[model samples]
Target: MGWVSRLSTVIRTQVNDWVGAVEDPEVRLDQAIADLQMELLQLRQSVAQAIATQKRTERQRGQHQTWAVEWYNRAHLALVKGEEALAREALSQRQSYLTLMAKMDDYLGQQRQVVEQLKGTMRTLEQQIAEARTRRDLFKARARSAEASQRLHTLMAEVGDRVTGGVFDSMEDRVLDLEAQAAALTELSQMQPTVSLTSQDSRETTASVEAELTVMKTRLGQG
Candidate 1:
């Protein structure tokens, strides 16, 4: 019996602790949602950064193309003027610009790929967040229902303990015994209560009765 009582106490305490923890599920779910939102925001920022980089690369490519054209034009003019050294220098500059333009084109292509990947990741995350929201609510509801069930089980345990000869049962028995004793005493008192009241005793009794009547009236009014 001692071991059984101790085990019951432990189980009740653990269930109470678990029910108390149920309130935190909502907080945990919110934190999860917040974390996902932060990730999405960071991903969006990365996408924006990639787009900015792509735009800068495109602008650089366009500038290089323009520079190459200008250099080619200068090279042609120098050749027409019979300036071979100047024509050669202009053609070399134009080749360098064409090389840079080609590299920039490749970089731009890679940047586009990165941007597309970011978009795909963002789409996946959005879908995941939506799914998580649904799951979060379901999880919270289940936690709440489980907590209520645990409380009901605890209450039943307490009632069962009272019914099965625990302290509460003893207390109930003591109350019934006292009630029976009081009934016996009352019957004895009623059998012998025929004494006549003297004038002074009657006056005191009247005063006491009046005071009790006033108190009862006041309580009734308040109620």
Candidate 2:
């Protein structure tokens, strides 16, 4: 009895400890989910920023191309008017615009590359977020299961104590009664009528009556 009581106490203590650990794991899982969500938000912002930068670079490239064309046209008109020095200066201005256009094109290309890279990164981050969410749910479910298992263990330990205290004596009596009833059923099945020579031989005897008298004597002794 002492060993049984000690074992039950140990089980209860272990269950309490495990329940606390399970609760901690659930909390950590939630924190991890929140952290992943924050990371996803940051990735989205980065993707948005990359897109904005790409758009700005594209607009700058277009504006520079237009300016370069306008400069070239002006330079050609001045040359056709025979203003040599003015045409020369206008051509120089046109060359400057062309240089600016080339630089803008290079920058636009870089911006486009950055945007594509950012988009890829965003996709990867989204995938990670999805995986994290799945893991969070799995972890949470495991935590809940662990907690329930711990609770059940604690309950079993308590119930085991109650059984020792005789609090469940009636339940024990009921269970014994059920067992006796099952035994009676088995006895009745053995006594079932059968088309056999041995059964016919016992049918006219007092075998069943003797079996009932024996069971009654045993029951009286036990009481």
Q: How much is 26 displaced in model 2, in angstroms?
A: 2.6
- Could you estimate the TM-score for every candidate? 0.57, 0.67
Screening candidate 1 with a backbone cut-off below 3 angstroms (N, C-alpha, C), the clashing residue pairs are none
The clash count for each model shown is 0, 0
Residue 166 in model 2: shift from native, Å? 3.4
Worst 10 residues of 1 by lDDT: 191-200
> RMSD to native for every prediction?
17.0, 16.5
Stretches off by above 4 angstroms in model 1 are 1-16, 145-223
lDDT at position 220, candidate 1: 94
Kindly report which residue pairs in candidate 2 clash with one another. Answer: none
lDDT of 1 by residue, 1-223 (tens): 3554565687789887886686677788889999999999999999999999899889989999999999999999999999999999999999999999988888888889999999999999999999999999898889878877877776766566656647877898999999999999999887665443366688899999999999998999952
